[model samples]
Target chain A: MLYREAGQFKTTYAADMAVFPIRQDRIALALLVAVAFIAVPFMAEAQVWPFRTDYMVRAILIPFLILSLAAVGVNILIGYCGQISLGSGAFMAIGAYSAYKFATGVHIPLAWLGTAISIPPLPGLISIPLGGLMAALVGILFGIPSLRIKGLYLAVATLAAQFFFDWVFIRVKWFVNYNSSGSVSAPDMYLGPIHINTPVERYLLCLSAVVIFATLAKNLVRGNIGRQWMAIRDMDIAAELMGIRPLYAKLSAFAVSSFIVGVAGALFAFMYLGAWEPLAFDINRSFQLLFMVIIGGLGSILGCFLGAAFILILPIMLDQIPHAVGIPVSVETVSHLVFIVTGGLICYLLIVEPRGFARLWGIAKEKLRLWPFPY
Target chain B: MVEFGQFLEILIGGLLSGVLYSLVALGFVLIFKASGVFNFAQGAMVLLAGLALVRSLDFLVARGIPMPVAILMGLMFAGLVMALTAWLIERFVLGPLVNQDGLTLFMSTIGATFILEGAAQMIFGSDVYPLPLFPTDAWFLFESAFPGGILVNKLDVWGGLIAAILVAGLALFFQRTKTGRALRAVADDHAAAQSVGIPISWIWFVVWLVAGLVALVAATVWGTKLGVQFSITFLALKALPVLIIGGFTSVPGAIVGGLIVGAGEKLAEAYLGPQIGGGIEYWFAYVLALAVLLVRPQGLFGERIIERI
Candidate 1:
């Protein structure tokens, strides 16, 4: 009775076409935002979850947010666009390295109509999107083959991007600013008087960025472009016959996906790992993001968040479970167990619920309205 | 400028490494041809098999077993582990998700890859194990025969020879054997083969087992050269360009693709590395393969992909 949408009639087309048409959804979203903005920051860091910064905010939420952003990007390409990419990590790395460069080395002199002007270097806040644009350009360049190759063959072709970017970052000193050690520290993120240095600040910054991107992603999918993407994904020839240009849809999907992914990469680097080497964004990172999108719920925006939470929090929970039971588990044993459990769970999810957690949640909601009735 | 002899040495050396890459790619082709599941776990299988082999060898030698006997026993243990892996995959991963889409199956294999990698590391401990090099004294002598002092590792020559024999053996098996013909049929049409009295799951099990065994042989050869370690699993990415250039389903294509990739990579590194600050070998094969793919969407040796409305 509490969850019912009864008597909530839509009076206009604008109200009916709303993202959250139900009044209850708007309230829930407001409460969620309120809790995230207010309650969490006030709570001190502790070993226990929910109130614990170490467990909840730092270890779990930060990575979850960053990965969710990346998952959204992957979801757009693989889920919405019908393009299977194995090089999400490559795009991420490009965004991160480019952002790092922009934050550090973008102070240049512009000669405009015989007048010389020195351009001030932008801060990390501005550099992140610039990094994303670079990745978008690169993503579109690599996406040229999608016109010809589809499915698994297209997936393999994308690996060329991953390996190529990886080599460039690792071997070329210019990308890493000639850091001989190959490990680069993320530039400080500053905006006037505000300094995003603390974990809370970092969490807020990442959360806001992810929320903005997630909103943009949802809006994009709900629009005509999203229809075009689904058209191509379902059947490119059919979509093309329907007057939806395959090249435009496919390339736009790549651009949008890579842009979000690139931003996520910058956040992943600067926010999560303070100092990172090229090895962090290897092929495994791409696989991890793909797994997130797959298990979260393909093509759903909420699925990205859900998938990221499930994947990132799983190992941490597994690590702590033995200790909670007063049995000391070796780190290596825990690591191995995490992998086996994770792999086993993925197979189970694919077999039993290939639609993933989002669909399951939808089913649950449907069942909830039926009350005490037995299906 | 590099001497003509030096160029020949690089070319020969590259061809040898390419042959090794073909062994890995051949394993992939076998499984892909039979099941249409591009088994991503092939590299993890190699790592697991190598770990089993080397660990078993260590166990035998520690107990004062003779060298030849220990080696044979280690090989047997590795084979046994591979067989067990095939059974596990058949039972859990493939059987339950039989009619899923291609991407779902591929993703499942990725899960399988992680589980195997973790389990292997847990069992064997993630330390690199070096094997005694197989004797190729004649190859060493030939290296000395070349001018400009370009040295070739004798073991690499033997690796190439073994790889050639492996390809020939596989070709014969596919040509002459009933199971091989069944695998080919399954590759051609799964439902038709199942209706025609070919057991699809059984064929899948055999393909995975055969692929696992191929992985084992490759691990032995590669472990001897590079010392079986974590990086070997990533070498699967290296073999990818070979698979792309040649074709995913063809054995001879893998071999030819490997030769082109291997030779091309080495030549680029030698001739163009100085201009690019070196290490061009890493991405050169992929770029070359991508260029080729642009010209022919169907790989050089792959069957033409036909799309119908």
Candidate 2:
């Protein structure tokens, strides 16, 4: 069988500890990367069957990749660290608005105090990570509560951050650069001399960013810090007794998770929406990301992508299904049905398979290893 | 003097609306106490119940039924609908998900919430339905002492009165009834209660039923106040702070928490809105709850949590 590891034995410790320990997994990953990087773009350029319209790439793939990246970040905190955060939208907003501030620059004049301060604009690429760093700083600040509150209470507490940041971005005109309409547009994105304007260009940009972040996240989770997070998640007291400081583990999880999520937010605003208000990163965004982590496998890197794809594709499929079948249903009815089916599916997943699609993939892999062997 | 009266008026108004919050929070406390599931769908339940009641009332009135009889029939129909919903949720959702971690259970309830919200909209129509069960007029008090008296809404007073009656009735039920004793026993320890011949699933169904009926009462009041619509689901968001401040496990804690949240947010909005950009109430209750959580993680009335490793 293709998945059988009978002839593949790791003689070195580094080889054994590699993220993709099995040969089949590494090959599969390479094939996947090839498809994402080369084939997809080639198809989009050639205007192939599914890629005839840029809508698929622009609308679906771009948001999917961005949300998947955000889910990876959220997975680090909730799935990896065992801290439930319903305030991820707040962190995303922080990343986005801060990135916007850094990219466009800001001028704050204290006329009453007879002083003024101004920030010079940074490049778009530079500001995205800077936005992430700002989110990390705020993530650390908010994560202080996790030391005391635990479980559902902590989840509810995180909403304070969501609502607070939402208010901050909406009410404080300084953040929005005093736009009377209270909406901000993405700054011009230039990678050296190349402009990321076209849908294909934007898709590739997001894809590459996702690749780097996903790889980094995978490596992080397999490292010592990830173990610390898992330990804290599994049993904080026991982990503490074992010399893993809950403070360090929890805060670092927040920092790393928020940083990734923040970067994703910047990408989402700049690449996807192009123009957005505070409503772009509201509580529902947090829930949507959380749902991705839930439906995807909790602790698996691959699960994030799987969950994001499934959650994103579901509504589209539901929308198309009725029309495809020639059923005359109102848009409202279809939307209501979408909610019902989504809710029903979530319940079903929780009840039947709490581990989600990742577990299903795992089961398939296990089966593959024994294919053609009867025993 | 006029400012003082205005302040009292705001305070009184806040306290009364806080009573309505308590009514919603009460449903959450009931389910959490009995089944360890934080029912996020309570707001949706309120919406569904209100919709059912209002729609039924409209139907009966259109058929030439008397006003009083129509009201009675609508209440009964809504109660039946709630009871059916309780049974279905317990059978399909909560029953299978028993003994899951609190977070998983909580998330599942949210899933349930989406289903209920969608189903309610589909069945009852998504448009807002007005329930004029109570007078919406305001009463002026102490006009002799002050040039302009404090204004109090009649609806809020009715809400407070109903909440008091509901609490008293619940207390009596818990104190005097066999089923109530069984419920308390189950809340104490699930395994032990099961060992002593209590049907855990049946108890869960009953608890959900009780919570459903409570949602009905809340919907009747809230629907009358705000008009039943999709926005009622958001009341779940507002009630969360109340649950946190009051402690998740205590009924009286819910009432007190609701009062604090209502008064605190209203006071902050009125006094602080001008200085700030307004809409402070949106996060004010949550911030207060967070502060409480920091000082007393178990909340004001929640039982002390003892973790074992």
Candidate 3:
């Protein structure tokens, strides 16, 4: 009854064009954001809740948020642009290492008359986007092939990028700040008086970063540029005939997509792994992000989070399922089961509905709208 | 100079290893030609083949079966497993997705890859299993003017011969058989073949069977060379650059591409690796393929793609 939009009528074009035109959807979204930002943290502080501070902050929420960010980033490139990239991990690595370098290597000397001013070493806010920018530059460079190649060949080209980046980062010591051992530490991150040192601060930082990037991605995909991308994706020849510049649309998609993915990588390094080497952002990372985009739903924004949550959280839940039921299975066996389940689900979902879990959610809502009587 | 002799040795060894690359690429070409699915599960299929053979052999041997009987039975059992895998793939994956787009089909195969990889690992734990069937004692030494003479493993020579025989047998099977002609017809036009009473489904089944057998042979040979483990799956990826360079559809292309990539990788790693902190073998083939692609996107022997308006 609450979902029936019967009493509401859009008086303006802006109202009709709103993202959540249904009042119930808007309310639900607001409630969700409020719960994520406020209620979760509040519950973490309470002594009674199952939301233990250490487990919630360190294990589940932080990784979930960062991966969701990556899913969004991958979705923008593969989903919106209609370009398939197996090098998203390479872009992520670029973001991470670049951010690491900026955080540690930069020292700005501010001069004002007789006084020498210094802003204490590395700030997380600036370094993250700087990392994104670096990734965007690299992304555009690698994206040069989409101009000449299409489909399966383009995929191989992207794989080339993955292998190339893997080689460059590991072989070139400069990316690692020339540390004797390749893995190096993230610098002390500070935003004025508040030090982002603890798990809660790191979680909050990642949460905010995810929210900002997601909103940015959402708007980018909804706008004119996003239309151009979908046009190229659906049919490049037709898109070009209609006066859409393939070069501009394709490159912009690469840049914007890489920027968000880059930010996610930065957060992944800064918040989650803390001190990650090049190996952390290998080909498997690319596959994980690609699977998220695919399994979530290719063309929906909400699909990103849905896909990320399913892929990231499902294995953990799968392990706990056998334990909770007292099946007495080993961890290795459980892990293997998890893999089989994941693979089986992917095939099943693709066969039934190639659009993914997000489309299934849409169908559920559609069914809810028509629930009282058979159509 | 010793360098020239060493270079010649590297070329020969690379060619030998290139046989493995060709074997793997052959699996891809056979499937892709029949169905446009670009089988990502080829690697997983290879792993399964290795596990299937070893596990079957062990299971039979413990029952007091003679060595030759056990070996023959194990090979037959391995073939049976591949057939079962092919049937499962056809029924569960390709059957349901008859008219789906290439991307969806590709992704589904990737799903199949994960399932097969997990299943194989689950059945036979992730330890490396070596099938020491090939001769390991004899070393062929080129006693040229090199300070350190070039040493060649006898197993590699035998491996090459076996691979050559397999390829020759496949070529003859394709050229001389009616089923092969029907397969080519199906590949040429699925709807056309169907209209003319060719069972497209059976053709697909046969194609997959052949591909699986090819994977089995490749995996067993590779296992003999190195060992059968999760890492053996990576050899399939090594075949990818070979496909890129040779052309995805051409049999001859796969062989030539494998040889070129093998030699290029070994030469690059051997000569220039020390200057670049080593490990050039990992990405060298991919980089080489990418460079070649920029010049000729159709690959060396791949059919030229025609984009229609």
Please report the candidate that would top lDDT against the real structure.
Answer: 2
What TM-score number comes out for model 2? 0.98
| Candidate fnat values, all | 0.58, 0.65, 0.61
The estimated TM-scores of all candidates read 0.94, 0.98, 0.95
Docking class for candidate 3: medium
Q: What's the C-alpha lDDT at position A27 in model 1?
A: 94
Which should have the higher DockQ, number 1 or number 3? Answer: 1
Candidate 1 stretches greater than 4 Å from native: A44-56, A107-119, B136-138, B141-145, B148-150
Quality of model 1 by C-alpha lDDT = 0.86
DockQ of 2: 0.69
Tens-digit lDDT track of model 3 for A1-375: 446676799999999988779998999998998988887777776723667547867788898899889889888878888888988898899899889878876433445555544434467779889999999998898788888886677788888888888888898887786788988778778878888887777888888888888887888788899999999989989999999999999989888888889988988998899888889999889988988888899988899898888888888887888789988888887777877877888899899877898999998887777777636
Docking quality (DockQ) for each candidate: 0.61, 0.69, 0.60
Candidate 1 lDDT over residue span B174-270, tens digit each? 8899999999998887778889999888988898999999999999988887787878897678888889899888889999999999888999999
Candidate with the greatest DockQ versus the true structure: 2
The reply for model 2, stretches above 4 Å from the true place, is A108-117
Q: How many residue pairs clash in each candidate?
A: 0, 0, 0
TM-scores of chain B alone in all candidate structures, in the order given: 0.94, 0.97, 0.94
Per-residue lDDT, model 2, residue A102, is 94
Candidate 2, backbone clash total: 0
Tens-place lDDT digits, model 2, residues A237-352: 99999999898999999999999999999999999999999999998899888888988878888899999999899888878887899987787887788678777877888999
Tell me the lDDT of model 2 at B267: 86
